[model samples]
Target: MTDSDTGHSPVWARSKRRRSSGGGGGAFFGFLVFLLALFGAVVIGMSIKERSVAGGGAAIDGWIATGKASVMQAIGKAPAAADVAVEKAGDAAAATGDAVQAEAAQTADALKKQ
Candidate 1:
């Protein structure tokens, strides 16, 4: 706690110097923010189309349209994807049950033969 002799740096200055894991969290958050901004632009794209709003560059408009379409398509496919996932899970469970039953039957047969 004494810093007079060596005049070491203060605790506050040295504290939390280690770099925490970046984990690309910044990139992910940036992408999310960009997505949200583009979605906002899509909402206002109507105004742009009708010239009620300005700053409607083709690239920005394209980004808005693409984001909107991707989102809507994903939303439309989600239910069907869930249904397929459920069906696959059921199939896997049935297969696992059959395998367990077959193993038990084999074990019983082996014990009887012995």
Candidate 2:
């Protein structure tokens, strides 16, 4: 049989056109909505992950670090200085008391010898 009579189609033949007119606009809008939803979902997921990373445990760590630094600073400044001052005062008082006791004992011994 001849090529035209065999009803065989060419590989490059154009396909049939669809009859719908407004389907393109609807498809475009649906795709746009899908993209917006996907973007929103991604943003929400990232925020949730970020929050978890910074939530109770992480917040507690930060507070603990701040407290530790504050304690270190307090230790570095006034309280330790006060402690040193108090120790020096105590040493001076004890030394003064010992000197007074020694003088009193010497005076008593001299009186007894006289």
Candidate 3:
């Protein structure tokens, strides 16, 4: 009897048949996402390891202090200019105080004389 009459297809005939389509692209994208997650975990773990080796919290503190110092230097006034400003403010305040006191004394004397 022939292979088709025996109810079994021949291997060559099966090989010649077209295969059904599958969700191959979805599976490939899922694998890529898994690899990316694995890579991210490894990178985070290595960063933690490096931070631990490089003084951990102290390193972070030092970085913060350095950043603060850099900002202060960038925004801070020069010492000489700051001193001059302070002196000018103090002199202006003193002069204002003296003028107010003199005005008050003159007002009091005028009231007493009247």
Candidate 4:
């Protein structure tokens, strides 16, 4: 029926043209987003590969690698430093035990002479 017959136009009779929102703003923004996503993927993948068994293989060995270091080199160094600290602590404990044994021996000898 016409709008004159009804109080107002029905939902199906409405002429609301939907604006196009499919286009990604423009080519520049679309490419920018693609590049950002690609860069992020590559960085994450390389960061993981850097710590893998096949990391920096003969293929990349010829490159000027600063010791096959990852971009997150500083983060990896923490474990190596902690290992060194543990080794030093073990050595110090062993040395302390030896000194205690020596002191005990000297005390025994002094008591025997008394």
Candidate achieving higher lDDT, 1 or 2:
1
Candidate achieving higher TM-score, 1 or 4: 1
TM values, all candidates: 0.51, 0.35, 0.34, 0.37
Cα-based lDDT at residue 58, candidate 4: 31
Question: lDDT tens string, model 1, 11-111?
Answer: 76666443345677868998999999987887588566756555445556777799999999999999999999999999999999999999999999999
- Candidate 3's residue-wise lDDT over 18-65, tens digit each? 332444775788899999998667556655966663455555567789
What's the ranking of the predictions by lDDT, best on top?
1, 3, 2, 4
Pairs of residues at least 3 apart in sequence or in different chains that clash in candidate 3: none
Q: Pick by TM-score: which candidate is best? A: 1
Candidate order by TM-score, decreasing, is 1, 4, 2, 3
**RMSD of each candidate?**
7.3, 27.2, 21.0, 16.7
Clash-forming residue pairs, model 4: none
Task: Highest lDDT: give the candidate number.
Answer: 1
- The per-model lDDT (C-alpha) reads 0.82, 0.77, 0.78, 0.72
lDDT of 4 by residue, 1-114 (tens): 788788887565554422244354666687999999986676566557787535634324535365556645977898999999999999999999999999999999999999
Residue pairs with colliding backbones in model 1 are none
